[model samples]
Target: MREKLQLIMKHLRQGSLQKMWKQTIWIYQYGRRYWKSMILYTLLGVMGSCVSLASSLISKDLVDIITGHQTGRLLSTFAAMIGFAIANLLVSQASGYASTFISLKVDSEIKNDIFAKMLVTDWESLTEYHTGDLVTRWSSDASNISSGILNWVPNLIIYTFRFISALAVVLYYDPTFALFALLGIPFSALMSRPLLRRMRNNNQKSAAMNAKMYGFNQEAFSNIQTIKAFDLIHFYTDRLKTLQKDYISMRLEFQRMSILTSVLMSIVGFIVSYSCYGWGIYRVWSNAISYGTMTMFLSLSGTLTSSVNSLTSLIPSAISLTISAGRLMDIVEMPQEDYSQDHAVKLFEKQHKTSGIGLTMKDLSYTYHSGTEVFAHASMEAYPHEIIALVGPSGEGKTTMLRLILSLLRAQSGEFQICAGSDHNQKLNMSPSTRKLFSYVPQGNTMFSGTIAENMRNVKPDATDEEIIEALKLSCAWDFVEKLPNGIQSVVKERGGGFSEGQAQRLSISRALLRKSPILLLDEATSALDVATERKVLKNIMQDTYPRTCIVTTHRPTVLNICTRVYAIRDKRCEVLNEVEIEKMVKEF
Candidate 1:
C-alpha cells in the first residue's frame, strides 16, 4: 500500500507545469485555431470594464450636483449614469457569450489531442494506468484546467484590474480611508493559507477515491456473471460500501475547510466595513468631507471589500486548478516512443521478400519488472502457407512469446523480424505500419461493443459487404450471423454478450481473417469453442482459404493437427518437434 501511494505521489509531483508546458502549449495552439472568438471576447471584456467604471463615476457626479443644488448638472449626470448602465449590460452579455464559445472550443481540442496521444502510446505503458484513473484525467481533470483558463483566469484578471482602479479613485478622494480598507489584505491572507492547504489535500484525496470507486464499479459490472456464479455479490457490495465511506469522509473534510474560510472572511469584512463607515462619518461631521464625497466613498468601500474577499475565495480553487494541471501534465510528459523518424523499413514493396509472410525470432529473451524471466534465448520461425503451433505447460510463457513476436511487448534481448518474400532477405523492424501488418486474437476473445459490421470495419475499414460475408463464411460464423435479427448489422453488447462463447470466437476469427495481413496470431482464440467448431475454423484457415503465415499457441494436441510445424516449449526453451515426436507427445497427453 505504501508503494502504491508513493507511485501516486510520484505522478502528482511530475504533474508540474514546467514538465507539462509543451503539451499545454500544443493544446493552446489548437485553441487559438478559433482566433476570432478569442479576439471578440477580449474586446468585450475591456468594453464591459469601461462601462462599469463609467457608471460608478457618473453616480458620484450626480451626488455632487444634487448637493450643490444645480438642477441642470444633476439631470445630465443622471442621464449619463443611465446610459452607462445600459452599455454595461450589453457588454456583459457579449462578454459571456464570447467566453462560452472559446471555452467549448478549447475543451473539444484538448480532448481530441489527449485521445490521439492515447492511441499511439505503447500498450505496456497503457497497462500501467487504470482505466478509471485515465477517464478522470481525460474528462474531469481537463475540465478543471479549462475552467481555470476560461473562467477563473479571465475573471481574476478583470477583478484585479477593477480593484486597482477603484483603489486609485479612493486614494484620490481620501488616502486615510483607503488605508483602512486595505487592512483586509493581510487578515485575509492569514486566514486563507491554512484553509487552502486543507482544501487542496482533501480535494486530491477525493479525486483519488472517485477514481477507485469508478474502477471498482467497472470491474464488478463487467464480471457480474462471475460474481453471481460464485455467490460473491455480498462481498463486492461490502467493498463498495467501504470505498463510499472513505469518499464521504474526504468530502466532509473539504466542506469543513470551506466553512472555516467563509467564517474568517465574514469577520474580516465586518471589521473593514465598520472602520470605513465610522471614519467617514467623523470626517463628514468635522467638515473635512462633503456629504457627496462621503456617499461616494461608502459606495466604493463595498466594491473594494468584495474584491478582496473574492481574491481570498479564489485561493482554494486556484490550488485545485494547480493540482488538476499537474495531473494532465503527468500523462502528457510520459516518455513516448518516436515513430515519426525515417527508420521504418518498407517490407511490403521490397523485391527480396519471401514468397509469403514469414516471422523469425532470433535469440529472443524477455524479463518482466519483477525479475521473473518469461523467456530465455527463445527462438522460433513460422513460414507462409503454414501454421506453427506452440505447445507448453501453463506459465511456460506461450502467451508471452506470442506477444513478443507481435511486437506488443518489446524483447529485452535479441530481435523479432519478418523475413518474407522471394529471397527471405526482407527484414522488417517494428514500425507503426509494420506492427499493423498482422492481426491478433488474444486469449480471452474480447470483443468491443458495436455492430458486427462496425467490428469488422475495425480490421478492414474499406472492406466491401461481399468481402466481409466471405470472411465470416470462412470462419464458420455466417450461419449464426444470418440467424440474428439484424444479421451483419446486429449490435453486440459489451464483451460480445447475447452470443455463446463459441459464437464470439467465430466472430473474432472472422475479424482477424478480414485483416488480410501477412501474419495471423491466435493465442488460444479457439479455446472457448467446442472441438467441432474449433476444428472447422482451423481447417478453413489451413486448407480452404488464403494460407497466410500463422502462429497458434495452445496446449491442446487436437488443435495442433493442422499445423505445418510444431514447437515444444519447456523449461524456458523452445524446441522444434518432428511429426513422430509430436504424435508421441500427443498420445502421452
Candidate 2:
C-alpha cells in the first residue's frame, strides 16, 4: 500500500502541472479578449450536450410505453423526441460556427503579434533562433494552441457536465450501478497520469524535428545552383531521405505510444461497462427494477463511461498545448529593442541647421559570447563632405564594426557618438526611429523580385519618377537603366536576374541613394565593378550636393585613393594611415 501511494504521487508531478496551468492561463487571457464569443460558444455546447442526454433519457420512456408498463400517447411522445432532436441539431451547428470563427481570429492575431515582435527584437539576440524554428513556432505551434482553446477546452467542459448529469441520473435509478461508474473514474485518471509526460516529450521532440527538416529543405533549395554545379543532386537527395526517415520514425513512435495508452483505457472502460451490465441484469432478475429503469441504467452507464474517457483524453491535449505554448513564449518573451527614445531625433534636428551628421567611436571594446575578441578600445571618426575607408584583411572585424555602427550589435564598453553640424555630440544607437538616419548596403545581392522603380521606391514609397531618376543618375546607373526597354519600369527577377553582378550592384546603390540618409554605409558595395566604374560611382557619391558622411569598406587600392582618410584594422587595433602609410599598403596589395 505504501509503495502504491508513492507511485501515484510520483505520476501526479511528472508533467509539471504548475507549468501547464500557467501556459493554459496565458492562452486563456488571449482568448479572454473575445470572451463574449467564447462564453456563448461554450454555453451553446453545454446546452447541446444536455439536449442529447435528454433525447437518450426519453428512449427509456419510449421503451416503457411500448412494454405497456406506462401508458403513453404515442403521437405526443414521438413529437417530443423529434423536438429535442431538432433543438440539438441547431445548438450543435451554432456552436461549431462560433468556435471556428473564434479559432481563426485568435490564430491571426497571435501570428501577427509574433511576426511584429520578431522584427522589433534585438538583432544579435534574434539571431540565436534558427529561422525554421521561429517559423514552426509561429505557424504549427500557434495553430495547435488555437485549436486547444477552441476544441479541447470546450470539449472538456462539455464532457464534464455530461458526466455529472449522467452519473446523477444513474444514481437516481440504481445506486449500485453508480458505484460502478465511480470505478471508471480512478482508472481513467491512472491511464492519463503516465501519459502526460510522455505525450509532452513526444510533442516537443516532433516539433523540433519538423523544424530541422524545414531548415534543411530551405537551405537545399536556396542553393540549388551551387548543388547542380557541384553535381551533388544525389548527395542532397540522400540527406533529405535521411531527414524524412528520422521524422517518420519519431511520428511512428508517438503513434505507438498513443495506441498503447488507448488500449489500456479501453480495457478499463470495458471492465466498468460489463460490471454495470451484470449488476443491472441481477437487479432485473430479482424484480427490483422494471424494464424501463433497467434500460435507463444501462444507457446512463455507457454515457457515463464514455464521458470519463473523453475527459481523460484531454490531459494529452493539454500537454500538447503546453508544449506548444512554451515554444511560442520562447520567442514572444525575448527582449525587444527600444525604438521610441527621442534624444537622437532631437539632437539631429538641432544640429542639422549647422552641418551634416558625423559618427565618432571612443574607446570601444567588443567580444563575442564565445570569448573571441573582435575589437579593443578602438576609436574612429567619419565626417560629412568626406569619405572614410575601412581597410582590413577578411574577418578582422571590419563588418562587425559596420554592424556596430548600424546598431545591429552593441559593444561591451564604448561610446559611439553621433556628431551633428554643431560640436554637440551624442551617443549613436540603433532603434526603429533612429535607423532612418543611416542607409546601409551590405555585400551580396539584396534585390527582390520587382520592377526597378518599385525596388527604388521601397525606402521612399511616395518618391516621384523625377526623384528616382536623379538618384539613379547619382549612382551612375541611369545610363544603363535608360537603355532598357521600360527603363525604370523594367521588371527584375529574384536577386536581380538577367543583370550582371556589376549591374545589380549599381542598382542596389541606386536604391540606397534614394533613401538620402545623412550617413551611408557601403560594405564592399562596389566589389564587382571595374576600377573605372567604381571610381566614378564613389566620386559621385562623395561629391553629391547632399554633403553626407560616407563610410566604405574595400580591398581595392583605386577605391581607397579618393578617401579623405583610411583606417586599417589589424592585430585587434584600428589606426589612421597617412599618405606614406597608404602608399605602402597599396604596394603590399
Top-TM-score structure, candidate number: 2
Q: For residues 346-452, what per-residue lDDT tens digits would candidate 1 score against the true structure?
A: 43524333356677787778887668988888888887778889998888888988777766677788867777645466677654556556789888847789999
Checking candidate 2 for backbone clashes, the offending pairs are none
Superposed by TM-score, candidate 1 places the C-alpha of residue 218 at a distance from the truth, in angstroms, of 1.8
Instruction: Please write out the lDDT profile of model 2 over residues 1-589, one tens digit for every residue.
Output: 7986887577567856567777888788766666676567678878987898888777778777887878988778878889998998888888778777887887788778767877888787778988888888889988887777777766878889988888788877778879976777887777676787687788889889989998888788878888999999999999999999999899899899879877887788788878877887888789887677878887788888888878878888888888888888778777777777567666674568347788788789999867899999898998888899999989998899998888787788977767764464544554446666888999988888999999999998999999999999988889899999999999988877878888898889999989888889999999999888999998998888885889999988776778998999977778998898888877877
Clashing pairs in 1: 15-326, 353-420, 353-421, 353-422, 354-420, 354-421, 354-422, 355-421
Q: In candidate 2, residue 438 scores what lDDT?
A: 83
Model 2 — TM-score against the truth? 0.89
Clashes of each: 8, 0
Displacement of the residue 4 alpha carbon in candidate 2, Å: 6.9
By summed lDDT, which 10 consecutive residues of candidate 2 come out lowest? Answer: 421-430
lDDT of each: 0.77, 0.82
Q: What are the candidates' C-alpha RMSDs? A: 5.1, 3.2
